[model samples]
Target: MATAIRRLLTAAVLLAAAAAAPARAGTLPPLVDVAWLEARLGDPALLILDVRGPLDGEDVVPFERAHIPGSVHTDYLKDGWRTTVEGVPFVLPPVDRLEVLLGDLGIDETRTVVVVPYGSTSTGFGTAARVYWTLRVLGHDAVTILDGGFLTWRADPARPVETGPSVPEPALFEAKPRLDWVVDTREVERALRDDAALLVDARPEDQYAGRTVKPGVQAAGHIPGALNLPESVFFVPGSGRLKPVRELAALVPGTVRGFAGPIITYCNTGHWAATLWFVMHELLGMEDVRLYDASMVGWAADPKRPVERAVPASG
Candidate 1:
């Protein structure tokens, strides 16, 4: 049909653009602005992965409607990006499956991937952080997150937008999982017992104080000895962009800011924790930070695990 032919032609054009794109010179930063991305739109080594989905009531923008030219669309929430492991939701999937998913998206070790989120709320921005964390865990260091995300890109009407889904030219992607980047429940338990790592609870104050609990999590409070540092504080008010380093440092509590040990971030699931991990590990250059991928959902599933309830210090 005509429609099918048009799609094929569009794919051909995108592939051609990618093929002709110039090789990028240096390592890509962990975060890139709209201007930075626009300048390298057609880079063959760059993969613009639009991970827009319904996070925090933001409606999904169909790829057929508008997207960055030569970009591929992948729903971060609905996709197999996260899987349930041992009844713990939002856990990272096995390495083999991740390899298939990335390979299908035409992502490989050589490609510098840019994850694009909806850029409406902190929760939405977390989606990008989660994906960015996943890539790093898979030993793919050539990944970056788009600051201000897709909304920032659309803010200027002059910016080019492409319609219809981009057909990716599949490449073989191999996974080299970084076991140290993620910690399991037993590791967390050991850390709690030995006080080896700084447990930073990323849930809101209410949740940390046992005032509210996320529905699948059996517990009503955070883990023992964990300090509450809500993920929202890391972002600019009413925006997806993260606050400047100085502003972020000012917001961080003295306990966390002064600590010089291994840090672990956790939330209801690993979703919000990824944001904290990105901030600490990627932004703050803290090398020893790890993500509790199973987080509270997995920890609380066992009633034997001690959950602490305490009033967080007034800011």
Candidate 2:
């Protein structure tokens, strides 16, 4: 009983602080740490979106068990974040659907959204990145991701965690879609034909080399002229956290670093490609970086499209 009272008192203090705080304006960073979040706990303009889900053998922890105070929960995998359109799986949902989803979450242009993932693996981090990309493509610039996610937040015992569900008051969320941030198969073909954009394949080397293929994708190799750079390299070794900016820049090949053309990133289902897109577009601040959301699955569905297999060097 005493513990419950203490928790309530902590929440009250945070709420009071938030009510007294002045509104902040200006651009938000692409990523924020636990310390930065903890300081802004009760701010009314801040909305903490906890997107925890089953990924990489980790069981989903119920939001009622424990979550950051004032944070809302949404399952990244099961939620209507992505949908199939014209047989292409995992493509962005329609604008009206996205508007309803965001509005239901009490997300509007006035609030700054912070997306938190499970942060257990690189794939798990991709969930947050994918959501971030969705928001950016929707023309929402007041968004940022929680680096290291809930795992890092839970690592510290000093941070206050609340139990029970959080219900947000619904708000009107308008969608302002940005066509340039997303590219279609026709656009990709045109770019390839014109040698206009640098295509990047964010898949494992074996898959990129045609040695392995995913289940749903029809092709066994990468898009022709695409450079292979697996998304795993962006994360720190054995952790979900991203590497420092300088280190991340160093990982890019000289060819990619020197290329001045627009860049298009893709993977099997556009899941992994979202991470690469986040790194290049958001973290690196590269201009004209776009995501081929349909990715290999859509590309290979057309048998007429060309696929390339990297020739192995002779021993």
Candidate 3:
């Protein structure tokens, strides 16, 4: 009982802080802000990636022409680091395919790749978060997301953006799944029953209520006992900055409600879940956080599983 109270108190404190704290407009680790990015524009070990995919715009090169200087181009929407999921559209690729793809992008275990998306939309950061989750799942921790995202950088014309692609020698990015970084459908099966795991759905309410399950998924509901906390909830609108830690506590109830030590975030395709990963793992300073890489598409596809459209019982 004491432990539960303590966790609840901790969560409350986090949320309060988040709500009260001043807005910090930027990314995690305090290293991805514009000042930081500006300072490291020419660093060798750091690799900048303009991952604005084939956006609905006028021309390709035209967009690339106005990117952050020294930033390389990669269609965050196109060049996927994944392959067949046996069923789903955005399933994670095999380890080998992922490694080869990263290598081709000139990314290796050593390079500190900073992803740049087109706008502050969750879509852009979602893409970056997905890649970040991939690296973490593959066992690399040197990754970081641009807090304010690409549009923030471009908003300032004085800032530099190169016109072409930047390529590097293929580097070996090894894969050693930190199973703890992610939880699969089977694990969710058990974790749902376990009081220790906080099942957080990073999707919006409509999806949680059995509306948008995405194509190919067998169901529209959510994992039984999961809470609907969309990934966008944590962000300070327009800025990539997350809500203050304390403030988030109020918005996101902690594991105190008979919940467990760590939190697991999930969405239909594992995309929005990555945003939650950034919020919980990096912003709120929660270490025992994991992203459901397979998410709902992987979970509901199996006929053996059952989903719940209503809010889980807190009692």
State residue 10's C-alpha deviation in candidate 2, in Å.
Answer: 47
Model 3 per-residue lDDT tens digits across residues 70-171: 667666556775444666567677778877777777777677778765654665677777777787677766667676766777778888777665655667
- Summarize candidate 1's per-residue lDDT along 1-315 as a digit string, tens digits: 998995675555444323322222135667789999999999999999988777845465776799888898877877699999888888999999989889989999889999998788899888899999998898888889889888889999999999987798899998888879899999999997888989999989999999998899998999999999999999889887898754554555656745778889999889999999887667655558899989999999999999989875665
Clashing pairs in 2: none
lDDT of 2 by residue, 124-228 (tens): 888888888998888887898999988899999989889998798899999889968888899999999999999999999999999999999898998888998
lDDT values for all models: 0.84, 0.84, 0.69
- For all predicted structures, in order, the TM-scores are 0.89, 0.88, 0.82
Error of 3 at 58 (Å): 9.6
